[model samples]
Structures are given as C-alpha cells and as structure tokens.
Target: MAEKTALISLNMGGPDRPESVAPFLRNLFSDRELIRLPGGAWLQRPFARLMARLRAPKARRAYEAIGGASPLRIWTECQTRAIGRLLGEEWRTAVIMRYWEPRAKEVLTHLRREGVKRAMVLSLYPHFTAATSGSSINDFCRHAVRFCPELDYRLIHDWFDWPPFLDALAHLVREALARFDGEQRHRVTLLFSAHALPEKLILEGDPYLDQVRTTMRGVLERLPEYRSRSRLAFQSRSGPVRWIGPSVTEALDTLVDEGVREVLVVPVSFVSDHVETLHEIDQGYRDYALRRGMTRFERVAAFNDDPGFIRAMASLVASRVPASWRDSRQNENGAPCQGTP
Candidate 1:
C-alpha cells in the first residue's frame, strides 16, 4: 500500500460567527506565545478572559462590518481543496487554525483516523513570527507528541521570499495597476502593508520584520515599474504599547505630503481575506486616504484561491514530500510543482 501522507496548513484563525468573536479573542490572548499576562502564567487565562470581554464589543463591530464573520475559514477551505487536488489522491490536506475550531487537537485526531504516517506542515504565514507561526507549530507539536507520537512530521518554517510566491504577488500588483487609466497609473503609489508587531519582537531578533522586508524586495524586484513608486508600511496595530514604525496611517500621511493622489494598497502579510484586509484595509485605510485628499485608493485582493498561489503552495508541499512517496501523475491530472529554484 502507498504510504499515507498529510499536508497541514497553519494559520491564525478568526471567529467564524459574531458570537464566536469574544471566545476567539479569549483563546488568542490566553496563549502565552502571543501576549504574556502581567501577573503570572497562572493569571493568563483570567486576564485573557477579562480582556476578551472588554474587547469583544469592538471586535464584534469589526466582524459585523465584514459580513458578520471572518472569510478566512472559507478561503482556507478553498485553498486546501485546491492544494489537495494538486497533491493528487495519495495525499490529504488539512487546515489548522490556531485560535478556532479546526485546531491542532482536532486536526491530529482526524489525521490519525485517516491513518496518516507522514505529515508535511506548512505555515500559511509566509513570514515567521513567535506569535503566529511559532505558537501554532509549538501547539501542534505538543499535541502531536501526546496524541500521535508515531506520526512523522516535516515543517516548512517560512517561504517568505519564495519565487513562485513573489510571482503571484507581482501578478496581483499588475492586476491592481490595470484598474487605473494610463494617466493615473503613473501616479498610483503601491503601498505594501503588513500586519504590525510590537517593536520588542524586532529588538528580540525575531526574523519576521527581516523576512517581510525580503519578501517586499522580492516582489518589487518582479515589478520594476513600481519599485520607485512603492513603499512598505505596517498595519492593524492595537493596544498602547509602541509597535513598528511608518505605520500604514503614517505612510498615507507622508504620501499626502508628497502630493500623491492615488494609492494601491497591497496586503503582503495576509493571504486570505480577514478583518485586517476587509475592515482595516478596505474600510479603515480607504477612508483615511480619501479624507486625507487622496482621489483613488484601492486595495489589491488577497491571493485567496488564486491559481498561481495554489500552484506555489503545491510546489512547496511537494518539495517536502519524500521522493519514495512522490506521486508520478502530472499535467492534466495534477498540479505542476513550481517553486523557488
């Protein structure tokens, strides 16, 4: 019998419904890997619960703005199916959301039932961070050891500057640019926005900022037309603690100072549509840009289920699959394996 193989995509999950918002926040805050409680590890849960209660109303409103729930799980399901098709019949693909229902425990249980012997875990986050990829991978490993110790696992930590991934982004940028007329195209500033993390993470030597910068460089290298007109900014910063510099808001202000009237926002950090993309970027930043006298402000859609992105993800997975278990099918029947050479 062919060896049973499983591919797992790790992500930071959001609430699927309005009611789940508070609980989701609670789960997110409770994770020590994300934010440490002021008191002690023992107080983490209580503090998280309290903070969740306080933040839920605002979070719910954000979710309400974007069709009552996050579109992340929906997009992730489509992505998994696309990748599964690419992987052919011998392999199975599963999504593990760190703070949501389809979590590591459930994923491991399902994989065990499927008789999976080898697993290739892929972090959906192109850039690695202790809060996101680190937390998810650590949670999965701890559970896998306790629940499915026999399972063999391989992890692709980060594919930040992967060629195919950059290709997909460049394609999206070109598509976004096409929306403007020729006269306006030259004036459109390509703002590459990534989620903001606390400055302390960079000070502590987290590779996320460096990887994000590299990813930006890679994507810009693929689009010479936008290199001089492009800028990188951080977004979705919360709380009182100082975060990264040149935030999306501040970046927009600078554009206003430079008399840039048109902007095309590209969310480089996120692959799927979520509150960050929908509410934050679309509603929040668009409004900010317009009120600041920008005539045109549009956001490039997330690479959710895009064929090139799916192909890139498939290639990433296939590269990690043992040669003995690699499926021989190709062309019309299977996805082409294309990645960074």
Candidate 2:
C-alpha cells in the first residue's frame, strides 16, 4: 500500500450479490439528493424502505437477466487499479461506491490505516449532476469529517470531453458499425442513450442534460461519418415525475417509423458495464425495439477499463490534480483541522 496518496473513484455502485438488491435499492432511494419522494425528509428513510421492498423483485429479475448481479464493482475495481498503475507507484487506489459496499467510511478507514496523507477524488460519472456526482462527493465529505477529518482531498469533476475519452467512444462506435454489412452500415442509425434525470432537476439548473448533449457533439465531431445518422435519447427513467426525453422507446419508435431498420445503441453516460448497459439496454430495450419492428439492434461495448479510457483517466489526473489538497473536514471544536486522517 502506498502511503503518499490515495486515488479514490466514486460511482453509483450496484448490488453484486443476489441478496443485496433490496438493500441496495433502499440505500439508493434514501438519498434525498437523487430522488425526492412525496414526503418530507422525516419520511425519506421509511419511504425508501417501502419503495425498495416493492421494487426489489423487478430489480432482482433485471439483475438475474444480467448474470445474477451487477458487475459494476468489478469494472470499477479494474478501472481504478489500471488508472493507479498508469499514475505510477506512489498512488494507491480504491473504489468508494455510493449506495453499496466499500462505502466512504470503509475506504477512508483503509486510507487512514495506510497512512495516506492526501487523496485524489474522482467521480465515475463524467457528467456533473447534483443527484449523481454531487451526492457521491457529499457522502464522501460527510464521512471524511468523522473517519478521516484531517485528510487532504481534491476533487476531479467532469471529464466528458477528455480527448482520450472521446477517442474511446469513437472507437466503440466504429466497432459497433463494423458489425453491419458495408451497405447496411451506411443505413445504421446511431442511437446514443443517456441515463435520464428528473425534469425538475434540470429545471432547477442541473447542467447534466447540457453536458450530455455537449458530449454527444464531441463524439459526433470525431466520427462525422455518423453525425447525420446519430440521435440522442434518455433512458432508465422511473418514478412518477417527468424525466428528460424523448426516451429510448420514443426514439426507437420514430426511427422505426422513419424506415430505419438497423440501430447501434451507445451507452453514452456510463463508463462501465452494469444493469443499465447489460440488462436495461441489452435485454430490455433490445427486445422492445425488435418487437416494435426493428430488424437489427445492438449496443456498443462498455468502456470497462478500456486502455483508451484508462489513459484518459491518467491524463485527466495529470492535468487536474492539485499539488496539494485542502482539508474539508473540521476539528472537534468546529474549526479547521490539520494533518492527514
């Protein structure tokens, strides 16, 4: 273990075991930052438990469809380790998942034990959103104040346009397109699907939608060959509130009606394989599109520690990591704290 510094990657992790699904959902719904139920904060935990109990069966089926559990932690572990190697030996790394195990308290405890004086915090979410990235950062900060109050930390935010990241997207797009015959390739509609955010959040000034669009523009610019054929749509929408759209379903409908026969789906927002990519898009939407009149439907391979993406993380760290981090934790007296955790 490296004592100099630790690189911690944050993500919306999933249940990797069969029994964890319900508890995972409960943990997720409890985060008021992400989903706000009809009740006030007082009822958030109770509501979360109820929601999780009600939805767990469906969620479990989805997990079972994707090989019995979420592979997110595996992917995140691979990514963080690869990135740490690229950043050189002085830096140790860990994955601190939101709404799952290896939580902030766990990671911070390990870092403290390793005598890590500094930490470089990076979010797996490339797009900045209060619900996703913000929640993760806040969770880490809250835990740090108690478990590692003196630890120096710096946050690395959105890197959606990091050059190597765009390169990775273009490469995946080309790979997916290659599956089609030359003539059919020309006809394939590129459907870039991003996770949906609540419309209320966007209205309240979350830049996530705009950032997603900008990322699309970046990738399309790199692969101008598919620029005209590409379409952007949102996915994984749930709850009673309106979400950003047109949804993946609506987009497919228009494509099918427009006489588009082949579609190549891209999981634009996620950096790794999880339920969203493996189950939601692969099993759910793929079946939906085929049943609704699409001859062929396919999704691009997830990044999942792809060499280019790891390089992108390295580059982002090199460019953005501060020489020293500011300690966000406070003393027992509620004043500025000093030293490492």
Candidate 3:
C-alpha cells in the first residue's frame, strides 16, 4: 500500500527519567526469553512486579550517580538522525527500543503511517544473542505481523567483524590508548567487557560468546600492539542464575596479581553507553580497581555518534536495503550531528 523504504534500528533502550526506571525493570524482568523465573510462565508477571518493586531503589540510585538518567534514548535518537540524514529523504529512519518507549509496536505503527512499504530492520547489537538481539527481532516481527502485515522488512542481524564496525572500534581503542604516555600505553591491559547472559543460554548453543570472541580477534588484528594485553571479560551480570565468568571484578583481580596497575577497558559488545558502561564499569569497576591497588583505569569512550561509526552504519544500511529503493543524498553540509536539546 506504500512506496518508500525505511531503516529501523533496534537497541535496548534505558529509562530516560527516574520514574521510568521501575517500569523498565518490570518489562526487562517479565520477558520470558531474556529471563526465566523459578516458577513457570504464569508466575513471570507476578515475579516481575515484585522484583521491580524491590530493585527500583538501587537502580534509581545507580541512575542518579550517572546524571539522574540513562543517555541511551538521547544517544539513540542522535545516532538514528545521523543515519537517516546519511541515507537521505528517500529512506526514513527510526529507532525501536527493546525494554522502553518507542518500542516495536509504536515504531511499526509510525512507519505504517509514514507510508513505508519496505524496510531494512538492523540490530544495533553487533553480536547476535537470543537474550538481546533475538528478543528484539522477535518482538519486532511479532508486532509487525499484527500492526503492519503489508510492510515488507528484511533483517540485518549481526556485523561483529564488519570491517567498518571493527574499524570504528579500533579508532576508539586507539583514541583511548593515546591517553596513556610512554610505557603506560603498552602497559595497560585492555580489559574488554560485555553485558553478561545467563549460562543456560550459552550451553544451549547460543553463539553470542563465539561471535564476541570473533569481534575481539578482529579488533586485536587491527591493533596488534594491544593484542598481548587485551582480554575479554563479562559485566552487568545479574540474577542468581549462573552467568558468564571472569567478570570485571575477577579480571581486575587477575590484572592486579600480574602487577598490572593500569587498565584500559573496552566495552566490546555495546555500541553506545548505557548503564553497563556509564555506571557498572565506570563507577563500580573503577572504584573496585582503585581499592584493589590499581593505579589508573580508563574506558574507551563509546562510539555514540562518532562520524566514523555513522559512516559504517550508513554503509550497512545501504547494503541491506534493496538497491531499487536505496538513495544516497548529497548534502552540502557534511556530517552534521544532533544531540538531545
């Protein structure tokens, strides 16, 4: 019924305000695919409400520490706008958050109203996992069928080793490493961390770990000097359920044992800053490392709206979108970025 094409970006959105935190937690905990409760499916909602009620206070404090809210929605908006501009007026761009506002249903309905006939649904997750990307994609498709069955959408799931993506990561890593001078540059162990997943998911043949490892290898290949010190660790591990190992704390402990005082942590999995990087590693890990006798700690600034990251994503959009509908705009104003105003 429509003619133009669309590019839908998927991300795990965060609470923009203090009041939204409880609801975000509830939605996150209630997701059966992302988290499995002790009881069966029938109990998930009840458990979610209780858990969210209990956890909200600490979560709100965490948000408060990081400027009273998550910058994810703002950053996602900025990133999507940049991507949209790059693709031109011919292609409409929008973002869908997994556990927050502007979710799949809302975005799909908006796209339908905008008269988008075909779409390239891209996962912001570079690595594919059932818990993250899978859940987002499944949610999008389920709602797409119900809300806009006539619209055609093609999925662009993962690009863990995509050259441009890897390059963007390398650029940030190099930028972070430059902060150190002389021996500290090479002395700092590159502690790469990613949000953790339940151990059950990995044991059941999820390729998330494998894909993340691949991304690490790609990044190391680009920066061979850091390869010797670079190591992968997991962060943001929650729940009583068994999750991935060599957590940020454990990794810090090992680095301390090895007489490594300085660490340059790279969030290998996330493309932008969220609670994981801004709060967990920046605050929690940094404080722990300091108390544990480490001298210096640094994190690779997230590639939020860096021009290079935008170019890479633009290339991805161009490739995934049908050539017939693809239209590259010639902008007299090159590489403009917008922030939350």
Candidate 4:
C-alpha cells in the first residue's frame, strides 16, 4: 500500500466510559498548563490528586445530565470523518482525545507504525488557551518526540481569525435571533459568553483573552444591525481566585435591572458542548435568568457537527501546515516535549 499522511484529530475527551473518567481527569487536572497550583510541585501534586477526588462526584453528576458522559468524543469523531471526507480519501485521519481514548502518544505511534511520516494535527479548539489547546499541543509535541521519533508534526494553533468560523458563528446567532418572538425582539439582549480564565494569566501575559476578544470583535463586525443589542460576558469560573468576568449570571441580572426581558446566550469561545456549556450555561444560568424574570433564555448552540465549522477547521489545517511536512516519507527523529523541528 502507498504511504498515507496521518491527520490526528484532537479533543479534550469525554467520560463515555465510566471506568476511565477518574484517570482521564487526573491527566486533565495534572496539566500545570490547565490548573495553576499555588504551592508549586508539592502543592500541585497533592492538590490535583485531591481535586480529582472531590470533583469526581460533581463531574459525574454533570456528565449524567448530558447522558451520563460528555459528547466531545463522539462529536470529535464525527468531525474527523467529516473533515477527512472534505480533504479527500488520500489523507488518513485519526481521532485522539487528550484525556481519553486514542491518546496523542498512541496516535503518533500508530502513524509511525503505518509508515506515515508527515502529520497534520488539528487541535479541536477554535481559540487558543494555554489551558486547553496549548496543553494538548504541548502534550502532543512532548509525546511525539519521545515515542514517534521519526514523525513530523504540523499544528494548527488558533482558527479564530478564519472567515468561515466567523461566518458560521454569525449565521448561527442570526438564526437564533430570527427565532425570537418579534414582539420581544427589542427586549432580547444577546449575551456573548466564553469560558473564563484566571485574571492572573492575563496579568502574566497570556494572549488568550485578547484572542477571544478579537474574535468577538470580528463577530460583532458582522452584526452591525444587531450591534447595539448584544454584550459580552464570561463563564465557567473555577478555583478561589478571580476569573475574567462580568460573569454570565451577573450579566443576566444586570440585564434584568436594565429592563431587558429576554436573552440569547451565545457560547462563542467553544466549538463543542461540554460540561461548561451543557451544565453551567444551559442549565445553571438558564435557571438563573428564569428566576430573575427574564421571560426567555436561549443558547446559541455550540458548533458541533456543523458543516461550516468543519470547513473552517479543514481550511485552518490546510493553511498552517508547513510545506516541508509534505516531503517527509518516514518518521523523523525528535525528542519528546520538543516542538516541531
């Protein structure tokens, strides 16, 4: 058989299999990139271990709310197949959930075994955050160099600037706006909500907030007609420290105070519906809005399984991958934790 180029589809993984959830979360919480611990290594280690235990029941509960597990894995698989089809059959695609099955390291190993040298890694995150896509790529690079010494990786960092993604988001929001009762249209306040990161990260010079804000601005440019009707807020705050806010719940209350009777919650920062969107935004904040006398609260659905989103993702992959990656016919020797050489 002729050699095939491998495209590893990456995601944060789901809890579809109950037995794997804890260990999966351990990997998740262990990433210093995700959760910053106060006490350095010792505190980081014990704290992560403790958090995994304390959060399991609650995490399990949240999973059960959305069908006893997360849908990220299934959604990612669907995206992989869709993107592969879009890219043509010449490309070999595999799905890997960083904290779940078909791990980053395993996929790299498999590609090496399959005699695939060139690799295109599409991080499932549309916007880059050190905690999410950053960690995933960091993990992939570290593992790839160590395990698949002969494989070369080309990574797609952030696709937030892509026109198609902005178009799709604009389209989705417009569609939701159209669905609102015409009589209440003026009363509908569009709330753009993204997952919150620690403010400390911003102070420390991470560009995540600026990137999402820029994407939001781009999205707003497409919304001139509705520009005056919407506002931005942050969501999914964890830990004891402050997170980027004007939180969604607080924003909802403020809208009520300002006489807005309806809200359209848009999950702009995320591409998939995970616990943050499903439990926190949909269930938690929806209830909060209802209690505060907001007559209607609707979420602009996450872009899962959307054809336009897949096109945007594929375009991102096509544009960013280095041309040299196309020439490599065998895995190239590289060390783990080291970036693409």
Candidate 5:
C-alpha cells in the first residue's frame, strides 16, 4: 500500500466550437512543445496569431458540420466519469484538454489548490509522440513544478504495449469483424490508420513511428485470423513538410483500384472519435472511398465507452495507484499494469 494518494491528469485533445476556434488553435500553436519555431518569441506569437485567424474560419466550418462543436470534450467527460466511478471517491480524476475548455494549466491549478501530494500525468493518447503526448507532458512538467513543487509525480509515458489495451483493441476488432456480411468478411481488407507526423520527426529519433508499429504488432499478434489481410496507413497531416505516408486516402484508392471492394478502417491511434475520426474518417475519407467506387467502407468504432476499454483504463489506474488508496498494493495480490508504458 502507498503512503500517499496520486491524482491522475489527462490531456483530452481540443475543441471545435466556432467561437472558441481562434483561442483554442492559438493555444495549440503557442505550445512550444508543439509547432517548434525558429524565429524570435515576439515574431512567433504574431505568426501564430496570424495563423489562428486564417485557420479559424475553415476550422469553424468543419466543427459546424458535426454539430457546432467538437464532441471530444463530451467523450472526455464520459471517460473522466467512468474512471472516477471505477476509482471510487478515494482517487480524484480531472481531465484537461490542451487546447480547449478546462485547459491543462487550469486543471493543474485546481489540483494544486486541492492539496494533492502526488500526481500521475496520463495523456489520452496511448502512443507517445512529440506532437501529441510529449507536448502535453512537457507543458505539465513546466507548470506543475512551479505550481505544486512539493508533489511527487509519476508520468505514464505511453500505454501502447499493455495487455489490457491490446486485448480491448483486439476484442473491438473481432466484434466488428463478426458483424461483417459473409461476402464482406473474408474479402475485407483491414486498414490501420493513425495521425501522421512529419518525416523530420522520425529522422530526429522521435519514437512515435516505432511505438505505433509496436501497437500494430500487438494487434496483429492477437489476431491470427486477420494478419494476412491488414495494412498500415497514416492521415491528418498538415503543413508542407513530408509526413509518414501511404496515406489512408491513397491506400483506399489503391485498394479500390486493385478490385478490393470492402475495407475496414481501424482508427488505432485515437481512443475517442474526435474531429479526425468523426469528420476526417467518416466524412472526408468515406466520401473519397465511395467516390472511388468501393462497395463498403466501414470504420471500426472508436473505443469510447466500450466495457473492455473502460476496464482496461480502470486496470491501468488501479495498477498505477498506491496500495494504501485501494488497499491491495502487493504485486501478486493486485492487478499488474498492462498498457503501453
């Protein structure tokens, strides 16, 4: 049993509300942990400000397509509540979206005010990448030390290789495969799509690509039946820089060109259906696939509130927390940590 309790912090991604787009994106771009800039700080702010102004209108339109705002926060709240329920009243959990409401700084401030003695920084992202989890962890580290200097911190870098997470992903994929029609089942090709990172980052020794590959490997090892048909793809890349390729849309087109009529897209990167999954995959890519003359283009549902997923998350929290909180700290007596470390 632990002598002290630990609070878990989360980065739930960003929002898409019309009114909030500029501020939200500005926050995103301002994070030095993301969008690394070479110019002076003064120039960077103006550059970011300008980009936010230019991008907000177009961003607002996309958000408007799927109801006037992003549903990511709602999903985050659901996850927070579910985790809270599973952890019970002993361990308090608060979510902080890096570029949206309940921002990271605010959550840290709240935890500080609550007098938390220890904390666990958990990015909703299971895979580690400088662009995603690294950015959030860097921000938390920078601020939390000054904000709560006395607190002990345990950061969960990644859960990409955990067994429960792998199991949950496998279970979800299996369930989706079972639902496919007889003609679609054996003929279906699996497309594992993830958010893209610049080629520069991969060359710079960022483990994002490797970690994702491990995630793919774990999924494949658990699915002996699907191994022969699945392929990996990348998506949602921005800017002019070269990104990890065999882009999802390009892959979809190629599959169609090759006479493969049915394809199942698994958004293995994201835990929730955010703008990328909800709009990009469902609307943009689905439209592209339909236009390319593909007969079926079904997306595996995001992990959202799946019981297996929730249980996996609970298990992660349980394993990470001290025994004093849950009264079962012994290694053999308590559940072992099972997600991507």
Candidate 6:
C-alpha cells in the first residue's frame, strides 16, 4: 500500500443555509481568538450568543442578498478537488472550516481513520493574523495533539507574496481594467481592499496589517503600470471598536472628493467568493460608490478555481512536501502541475 498524505486547507467558513447564520455567528464570536469578551473566558459563550442574536438578522439579510447562502463551500470544494488531482493519487486534499461544518476535530479524525501518514495544513488566507491563520493553526494543533499526535504534520503559514499568486492577481487586475474604455483606463483608481482587523489586535503585536501592506507592495511592484493609481483600503469592519483604516467607505469618499469617477475594487486578501466578496463588496460598496457620484464601480472576481491560482497553490504545497515524496510522485499519471516553483 502507498503512503497516504493529506493536504488540508483552512478557511473561515460561512453557513450553507439561512437557518445556520445564527449558529455560525455564535461559533465565530465564541472563539476567544476572534473576540475577547469583557467579563472573562466564562462570559465568552453568553456574550457570543447575545451578539449573534443581535447580529444574525442583519447578517441573514446580507446572505439573502446573495442567493440565500454563501458560495464558499462550493468554491472550496472545487479548489480541494483541483489541488488533490494535481497532487496525484498518493495525496488526499480536504478543506476544514474554522467556524462551521467540517471543523478541525472532524477533519483530523477523518484523516486518522483514512490512515494518512503525513498531513500538510495550508491556510486559505494568503496573509496571516492571530484572528485568522493563528486561530486556525492553534485549533488544528490542539486537536491533532489530542487525537492524532503520531501523524507527521506541517503547516504552510503564509504565502501572501508567492510569485504565481502575484502573477494571477496582476492578470486579474489587467483584465478588470480592460473592461473600461482604453482612453479611460488610466483614470481608473485601483483600490486594493483587504479585510479589516480591530486595532486591539495590532496593539497586541498582531502582524496582519504589516503583512497585508507587504502583500500590497509586492503586487504593486509586479504591476508597475498601476502603482501610482492604486491604493490600499480595509473592509468588512464590524462592531464599534476601532479597526485598521482607512475603511473602504472612507476610501470611496476620498476618491469621490478627488473627482475620481471611475474605480476598480480588488479584494486583495480573499481567494474565494464569500459573503464579504459577494454582498459586502459587490452590492454594498457598489451602491456606496454610485451614491458618491462615481460613474463606474467594478470589482475583480475572487481567484476561485482560476488555473493560475490552482497552479500557485499546487506549487506552494509541493514546495513544502518532503523531497522524497515529490521525487517519487513526479512521474504519477495526471495533468502536469503548472507554474510549479
């Protein structure tokens, strides 16, 4: 029998149905890594439930605006299969949602049962933060320690500036810019929007902001034509707490004030379509841009299963796997892995 390897991708999942919205929010808020309650650890669950109850209705409405459920799971499954096929028969890929179904514990148990000898945990988040990559890694590690300590496992923590990834983003940006009339392309303000993190996390030494900036710089360097016209802004802020800024709303306002009538929004941090990209960005931001007198507002689609993106992911995974494993599987029959590093 061949040695079975597991490639696990981590993401903050969304509810598959309307009824799951509240529970998903509860699970998210209940995570100490996500929200630090005022009272104590004991108060987390109750506060999370209260917050979820207060927020669920609004969240559900947002979800409803985009086909009544999130496309995250569907897209993630597609990515999983694509990567697995590239990795060949020796490796099995799976996606684990941080806040919903197919959680860490369940995935760990499943791999163990499948007799997987080695596992590589890959974060869907290109960038890292205590709230996201940190939390997911810690959660999986905890479960692995208790349930599958013997399994040989490793993590691909952050691949924000990977070459193939940047190439794919640059390609997408160029494609979106092409949508505008050639004469007006130079006037389009390319806004790179990343998910916002609370100021408190930065105060605690979280490197999310810095990493995001680094990613922005790297991407800009690759697309020198857009460097002067591009700007970075943060989005998806919730609660009253101060978050890294300028918020996407403020950025739009600034652009409107600057007499910029055309804008192209790029969700720099996200790889798959979810509530943030689907509704928050496409609908909410588009409306805000129009209301502010912008004549055009468009966003680049998330990479999803873009051929370049899958190749980048495969390259990242291959780079981390044992050399012996790579050498042994190099001749496996299947479509060749493209853009491999």
C-alpha lDDT of candidate 6 relative to the true structure = 0.84
Model 3, range 1-341, lDDT digits (tens) per residue? 13687778889989999999999999999898888876788899988898899999999999999998899888888988899889777778889999998888888998888778887778888888888888888888888888988886778778888899999999999999889998898688999897788999999988899999999999999999888888889988755689988888998999899899999998988888888889898899999999999999999999999999999998987766554443443324211111100
Q: Across residues 93-212, which tens digit of lDDT does each residue of candidate 6 receive?
A: 888888998887888888888888777778888888888777887888788887777777667888888888888888888888889998789899889999999899999888888888
- Tens digits of lDDT, candidate 2, 226-275: 88999999998766678999999999999999999899998888999999
Q: Which ten residues in a row have the lowest lDDT in candidate 4?
A: 332-341
Query: What are the models' TM-scores?
Result: 0.93, 0.93, 0.93, 0.91, 0.90, 0.93
Candidate topping lDDT:
2
User: Which pairs clash in model 4?
Assistant: 142-337, 145-336, 146-336, 149-332, 150-331, 150-332, 151-331, 151-332
Cα lDDT tens digits, model 5, 89-144, are 66667777766777666777877788777655567888888877877676667667
For residues 1-341, what per-residue lDDT tens digits would candidate 4 score against the true structure? Answer: 13467678767887775555677677777778878776787777777777778777777877778777777877778888788787768778888777777787777777888888766788777677777778888888778878888775667766777888999898888888888878777667779998788888778777778878777888889987667888889987765577888898788888999998889988877787787889888888988999999889998888888888888877767666554455644534322342221
Where in model 3 is the C-alpha error above 4 Å?
323-341
Off by over 4 Å in 4: 1-3, 324-341
Error of 2 at 332 (Å): 26
Q: Which candidate model has the greater lDDT, 2 or 3?
A: 2
lDDT at 337, model 5: 27
lDDT of 5 at 104: 61
Over the stretch 40-80, how does candidate 1's per-residue lDDT look in tens digits?
A: 88898888888899999999999999999998988887898
Q: Go through the candidates in order and give each one's C-alpha lDDT.
A: 0.85, 0.86, 0.85, 0.77, 0.77, 0.84
200 in model 2: Cα distance from truth in Å? 0.4
The alpha-carbon deviation from the true structure for residue 171 of candidate 4, after best TM-score superposition, in angstroms, is: 1.0
Q: CA RMSD for every model? A: 4.9, 4.7, 6.2, 3.3, 3.8, 5.0
User: Which candidate, 4 or 6, would have the higher lDDT against the true structure?
Assistant: 6
- Give model 1's TM-score versus the native structure: 0.93
